[model samples]
Every structure is written in C-alpha cells, then in structure tokens.
Target chain A: MSCWETIADYGLRSIGIGERLLPRSDFTLCQQFTLIGSGLIWNIYFGTFALLFGFFLATALAVGKAAKSPFIRKPSEWFIFVFRGSPLFIQFFFAYFLFLSLKSVSPVFDPFTAAWLGALIVLFLNTAAYSGEIFHGALMSVPKGEVEAADAFGMSGFTKFRRVIWPTMLRLAWPAYTNEAIFLFHATTLVFFSGFPAWQQRGDALYYASYFADKTFNPFVPYPILAGYFILLTLAIIGVFGLVNRRLNRHLPDAQKGRMKFRPNVIR
Target chain B: MFSFCTDPQSLDGLPWLACYLTTGKHMAFYASFGTVLILLAITAPVALAFGFLGATAARARFRPLAWLGKGYIAIVRGVPDIAFFLFFVIALDQAFEWIRHKIKCPDWDQPIRQGNDFVVCPAAKLPLSTSPQIWHEIYGFFLAVLTFAIVYGAFSANVLYGAMRAVPKAQLETAEAYGMTPRQTFWRILVPQMWIYALPGLSNLWMILIKATPLLFLLGVEDIVYWARELGAAKQARFSDYPHGDWRMWYFLALLIFYLAFTKLSEVVLARVTARLSHGQATLGGTGRSAAP
Candidate 1:
C-alpha cells in the first residue's frame, strides 16, 4: 500500500478509528510513527485536561494546606501526603479497583473503570497533590514583604490574597509548577501500563511504542522514536510554560526571573 | 505460623488473617521489599560513581568527552524513566546475548536480526538457559539494578554538575593560587564542598528512586506490585487456600502505606543528614540557626 494509504490504515489505529487490527508481521517505520503518533493523542488529552482541572484543585489544596484551622489543614495535609507518598503506578491500580468496586454502587463511577476517565482521574489527583505541595512550598515562601505591603494598604483576608498573595505565590511557584507539568505529561505514560485496561487497545504513546518493541524484538528503533516524540513534546511544554513564566515575571526586574529552567531534570 | 493455624477454615477473624498473610507467596511478597532495599543500596553508590564520571567528563577540557557526558545527561533526562526501564532491559539483554553469540558461535553464519525474532545460539544464552531458576531471577535483578543506575546516574550527573558549579569559584581560585593541580583542587575543595549544594537534589532523587521501585513489576520482577496483584485477585474457595474476592484495593492500600512510611522515614533521616552535612559549611545550613533553600 502507498504511504498515504498506510497512514490511512494505521494513523487512527490506536483509537480504533481506521484500522481494526494493528500492523502485525511487517511493522514499518511509517506504521510505528503513525500508530504511536495516534497514541500521543491520548497522552495529550490526559495531560492537558488533568493539568487544567488540577490547577484549581491544587490551588485549593495549597490554600487548605496553608490554612490555620486544623479542620481544613489536616485533610489537605493528609491528602497531599497520601497522593504524593504513593507511587503513581500503584495509584493507578488502586484507583482502577476502587472505581471498579464503586461501579456496582452507582453508574457514576463506571466511566472511571475505563482508562480515559480512571487514569485521567488518577493523574489529575496525583498531579494536584504534587502541585499542591509545590504551591504550598511557594505559598510559604512568598515574600513576607508582599503580604505586609497588602496589609499596610488596608487589604485583609480574601482581598489581600486575591490581589497580592495568590499572584506572588503563583509567580514563585511557576518554575516548579512547570517541572511538575512536564513530569505530569511524562507520568501519563504509566496509565496503560498500570492495571487500567486500555479499552480496545487504544493505549497511549508508550503503549504503542512498547507494542512495536514487543513485535519487532528491537527496542532501538521504536523506543527512540517514542523518545523523540516525548522530547519534542517536552520541549513544546517547556516553551509554553516558559512564556507563562515570562508573563508572570514581567513586573520583576531582570535579575529575578523565577529560575525557570529549560532542562527538565527534576523529580519525575 | 501459629500451631493453631492447622485448620484455617475453622479459624475465625484475626487467626485466619494471620494464616492467610503467612502463605508462601505472601512470604515472597514480603521478601521483595528487601529486594527493593538491596537494589537501592547497590544502585546508590554505583550510580554515584557513574554520575561522578559523567560530571567529570562533562567538565572535561576535551570537547568530545564533554559532549558525550552532556548527551548522556540530556537524553536520559528528556525521556520518561519507565520508557528507559522497559527499553534498556531488553536492549541490554539483546546486546549481551549478541556479544556472547558472536564470540561463542562464530561458526554459525546467520545474521542475529532477521525478522521479528532475536535468535541466538543456546550456548550464548544468558544464564546458559539451564542454570538454576534463582540464577535467572538474580540475572534479571542485576539487569534491573544496572538500568536504574544508568538512568539515575544521569540524573545525579545533572545534580552533581549543578552542584559543582555552585561551589564558589573563588575557592578554586585560591587553590589554584596555592599551586594546587586541577585534580587536587577538584578532590580537595570542590568534591568536599559540593555535597552541601547537592544534598537537596540528592535527597529528592532518593525519594524518586524509592517511588520508582514499583516499576520493578514492569521489568518482570515479582516485586511488591506483582505480588499484590497476584495475591489480591479473587481466589475461588475450591481452588485456593486463601480465598478472597478482588481485594487488590486492600493489597494496594498496604503497599501505599509501606511507601508512605518509607518516604516519611526518609524525610526524617534526610533532614538530619542535611543538618549534619551543613552544620560546618559556609552556607545557610552552616549557621547556628537553620536555613533552608
């Protein structure tokens, strides 16, 4: 078959859109690229939505973690501890089982038994906990002077926070937040590998890459391709996060740009 | 383990639980925790050596060697570690077997890679294919450790490189003024002081390494996650001694607790270690009052 037809055949194979069966015997480079590229869609979907939904939850969690009241602070601390303490792999397994058990209790959780919902929820909560810890650290580290300035201007409570504390906390948190975001995307690769079954084998990029690796008995080709894709995607994420970082630090003098790093070699 | 555990079915509540938990597979599951600790113990120093070499090469005056080090650090950092874990094990296995094949089976004329199969002579096979099962498990484990070291060595190289840079340039200059050779300066002043700078990053990496132990399951090692899934799956009463319905949630919960407690203990120990390391240094930790970055 022509390359275009080949693409047509396997491009959406991951989502079961075009091909019913994967390229079995004669796996070509084009097939690997096309199929793995299709799988990247799920990674992007899970990473993007988890990050978006996670930000608000993380902020709430960070705030709660920073709260003075034990009622609010205790749960937040425990939540962060539990999620951050456990491995994401195990989290995926536990979440799958939990969701499966809950499926009988109510139809609401049934969607979670599927990788799309279940894995995404796990990633979301996991990232939220990590980001919450990051934000909590940044919140604690936000300059005393900034809050003092707000109080001096007769601002108190929520107004003081909305105007002063939150922005600075975010600004302080952005660099680490960027790292967390990249790692969150990286962590999404674990979804299918975890207990959560990829419905119809519609797995993520690593899923397809591993599939090819298994089929070809050659790790060199497919894994590098997958790595190439991830590195590029990681670069893209860095580029995007870098822009937000610049905007966040626009008011600061040239000296303090929030240590926004290009190389993402931090905690995974 | 109890003598009263002779009739598990007749036992009720906690005694039955004790019997169930002490099953043979459960013993293996418990032993796997030691496997993780042993892997960490071995990998830490080996990876540090790798990182030391890598950082030294990256800082080398020679261009190609520096490029090699820089490339190693960059590529490993860019990919998800799980990918590396999965890929490297198979790759390393094949590479080893292929080398052995070339040496042992030179009379054989076939190419190693023909199609989807990686065919090799049985004589060249790792562990000789007839070695005791324990040897295979050990071999698999050694592969897991090597992969972890390689990947984590790169991570440490990054941290060490940054830490080396964080050392005050003036200290090196003073050593130079005293007519110290570059090697002398690196060992005496740079390496000694880099720990304070590297501590935070290394501590973080330690936690990450701890968290990464479960990926041993992916590497085909019967680590805790493997045992959890195995033992937690529902067992038919007729077929199995410890019959339970899909209790993987509880199994995983126990694993979760294991990890949390491990991480929490590490935090305490690391905090103490950090304080001890920083106590006499010139940085914030060296001061009478505690200072954290």
Candidate 2:
C-alpha cells in the first residue's frame, strides 16, 4: 500500500478511528513511521491535558504548602512527598486497582476505570507534586526585601502578593518547572506499561514502536523513529517554554534574568 | 507456617490470612523485592563506571570520541528512558546470540531472520538454551542490568560533566603553576574537590535510581510489580489454598508504602553523608566549620 494510503487509514488510529487492523506483515519503513507517528497523538493528548490541568493544582498545592496553618500545609507537604517519593509506575498500578474497586462502589468513578481518565489522573497528580515542590521552593525564596518594601508602602497582604511576590516566584520557578514538564511528557509512556490496558492495539508511540519491533524482529528501525519523534516533541516543549521564560523575565535586566539551564536534577 | 495451617481450606480468620500470606507464590512475591534491591545495588556501580568513562571520553582530546560521548549524553536524555530499556534488552540479546551463532556454527547457518522470527543455531543460544531455570533467570537479569547501566549511565554522565565544570578553573591553573602535571592535578585537586560539586547531583541521581528499579518488571524480570499482579489475581479454591478476590490494590499499596519508607530512610542517610562530605570545604554546607580562625 502507498504511504499516503497507510497514513489515511492509520493517521487517527490511536484514538480508535479509521483503522481496525494494524499493518501485520511485510512492514515497510514508511508504514512503521506512519503508525508510530499516529501513536504520538496519544502522547500529545495525555501530556497536554495533564499539564494544562496540573498547573492549576500545582499552584494551589504550592500555596497550601506555604500556608501558615498546619492542617493545610501538612497535607500539601505529604501529597507532594508521597507522589514525588514513589515510582510513578507503582502509582499507576495502585491507582488502577484503587479505581477499579471504587467503580464497584460508585458510578461516579466509572470514568476513571478507563486508561484515558485513570492514567491521566495519575499523571496529573504526579506532575502536580513535582511541580508543586518546585514552586514551593521558589515561593520560599521570593526576596524578603521585596516583601518588606511592600509593607513599607502600606500595601496589604493580598495586594502585595498579587502585585509583586507571585510574579517573581513564577519567574524564579520557571526553569525547574520547564524540566518537570519535559519529564512528565517522557513519563506518559508508562501508562500503557503499568496495567492500564491499551484498550485495543491502539497505544502510544513506544507502544507502536514495540509493536513493529515485535513483528519485524528488528529493533533498529522503529525505536529510532520513535526517538526521533520524541526529540522533536522535546524541542517543541523547550521552544514553547522558552517563549514563556522570556515573557516571565521581560522586565528584568540581563544580569537579573535567571537563564534556563538544562539541569536534570528535578525529580521525574 | 503454623500447625493449624495443615488444613488451609478449614482455617478461618487470621490463621487463614497467615496461611495465605505464607503460600509459595506469596513467598516468591516477597523475594522479588530483594531482586529489585539487588538490581539497584548492581546497576548503580555499573552505571557510575559507564558515566565515569563517558565523562572522561567527553573530556578526551580526540574530536570524534568527544562528539560520541557528548551525543550519548544528549540523545539519551532527550528520549524517554523506558523506550531505551525495551529496545536495548532485545537488541543486546540479539547481538550476543548473533555473535555466538557466527562463531559456533560457521557452516550450518540458515538465515537468522526467517521473516518475523529471530532464529540462531541451537548451540549459540544464551545460557546454552539447555541450562537450568535459574540460569535463564540469571541471563535475563544480566541483560536488564546492562540495559539499565547504559541508560542511567548517560544520565550520570550529564551530572558528572556539569560537576566537573562546576569545579573552579583557577585550581587547575594554580596546580600547573606549582609544577604539577595535568594528570597529577586531575587526580589530586580535581578529583578530590569534584565530590562537593558532584554530591547534590549524585544524591538526586541516587533517588532516581531507587525509583527506577521497578522498571525491571517491564524488562521481563520477575520484579516486584510482576509478582504483585501475579499473586494478587483472583484464585479459585480448587487451584490453590488462597482463594480470594482480586486484591491487587492491597498488594500495590504495600509496594507503595515499602517504597515511601525506603525513600524516607535514604533521605535521612543521604543528608548525614552530605553533612560529613561538606566539612572543611568552601561550599555553603561547609561555611560554619571552614570559617574557623
């Protein structure tokens, strides 16, 4: 079959659209790339939605962790600690089974029995914990001098924070937050592996890559194609975040701007 | 384990629970945690060596070797590590057997690639294909360790490379001025001081290593995750003593708590080690002691 015919059939294949059967034999390089590239759609779906929703929860969590009350602060601290400390693979397994049991109890959790909802929820919470920790660190490190200045100007707590502290905290935390985003993107692959069924032959990029590898008995071709797609995705992330970093630090002098170095120390 | 456990079907309450937990497969499940710990113990040193060599190669004077080292560090980081884990284990297995095939059966070769199957000469199979069950398990484990070493080695290379750069340049120059050779300077000044810079990154890497041990399940080793699922599946009374509903949630919860406690203990120990290493150094952790008049 022509590559275009292959693309037309499998392009939306990951979401269970046009194609019912995956290419089973005599797998061409073009077929491998097309199918795996189609699978990239799920990676994007999981990463984008989880990140979008996770950011707000992370912000709330960071604020809660920084709160004066022990009740608020302690839960946030443990939430971050529990999620951050455990392997995300285990979290997926735990969450999957937990949700399955919950579904027996109530229909409210029925959506979570599926991979799209359950796996996404786990990723959301997992990324929130890591990013929350990053933001909490930045929140603590917001310059004391700036707060003092706000107090001297007769600015109240809410006004002072809204005007000065939150922006600077984001500015300080953006570099590390960028790293967490990239890792979380990398982590979406774990969903399929972690007992969250693919529902069909439909799976993510690594899923399709491994599929071709199993069929062709050649590890060299499909895996690299998957890697190539991920590299492009990673670069795209850096590009988008770089733009945000610029906007965040636009008011700062060159010396004051904290340049985003690709330090990989932030927890996965 | 109890005398009352003689009749598993007859026992009830806590004794039944006790007997269930002590079943043969459940014992194997517990042993799988040890497998994870051993994988971590072996992979850490192997990965460190790979990282050390990679960093040294990155610092090599030869251009191609330097590029190769740099590329290894970069490309590995850009892709998801689980992909590498899946790819490298199979690729390495094939490569080893293919080499064995060529050497052992020079004239007897039917094509190794028969459409979709990867066939090799019978004599060339890893562990001889006739070894005991334990030997096959060991071979699978050996491949897993090598795969993890290659993947995480790239990560440690990145960490150590940055740590190497973090050491002050003037120290190297000062050593040269004191009539120290480059090799001597590197061994004495650079290596000794590099630990302080490397400590934070290495500490983070250690936590990552602990978290990554579970990936052994994906690599087809009977690690904790595999056993958790296997033992927790619903069992009928006819097949086994432990007839139960799907209890995977409880199994996974135990695994989660085990990891959290393991990480908590490591955090405390790592903190103490950091404190000791920072003594008499110039970093923030050392300032109090190092400022002594």
What's the iRMSD of model 2? 1.1
User: Can you write out model 1's per-residue Cα lDDT over B141-235, one digit (the tens) per residue?
Assistant: 99999999999899888889889999999999999999999999999999988988988878877888888889989999878899889999999
Q: lDDT tens string, model 2, A157-186?
A: 789888888888889999989899889899
What fraction of the true Cα-Cα contacts (under 8 Å, chains A to B) does candidate 1 also have? Answer: 0.70
DockQ category of candidate 2: medium
Instruction: Note the chain A TM-score of all models in turn.
Output: 0.96, 0.96
Instruction: Please report, as a residue range, the 10-residue window in candidate 1 chain A with the lowest summed lDDT.
Output: A259-268
Candidate 1 CAPRI level: medium
- Chain A in model 2: its TM-score? 0.96
DockQ, model 2, C-alpha based? 0.79
Model 1: CA > 4 A from native: A262-268, B288-293
Evaluate every candidate with DockQ and list the scores.
Answer: 0.72, 0.79
Task: Report the C-alpha lDDT of model 2 over B36-121, residue by residue, as the tens digit.
Answer: 88998999999998988888789878999999889888965579999999999899999999999999999974899888899998
lDDT of each: 0.88, 0.89
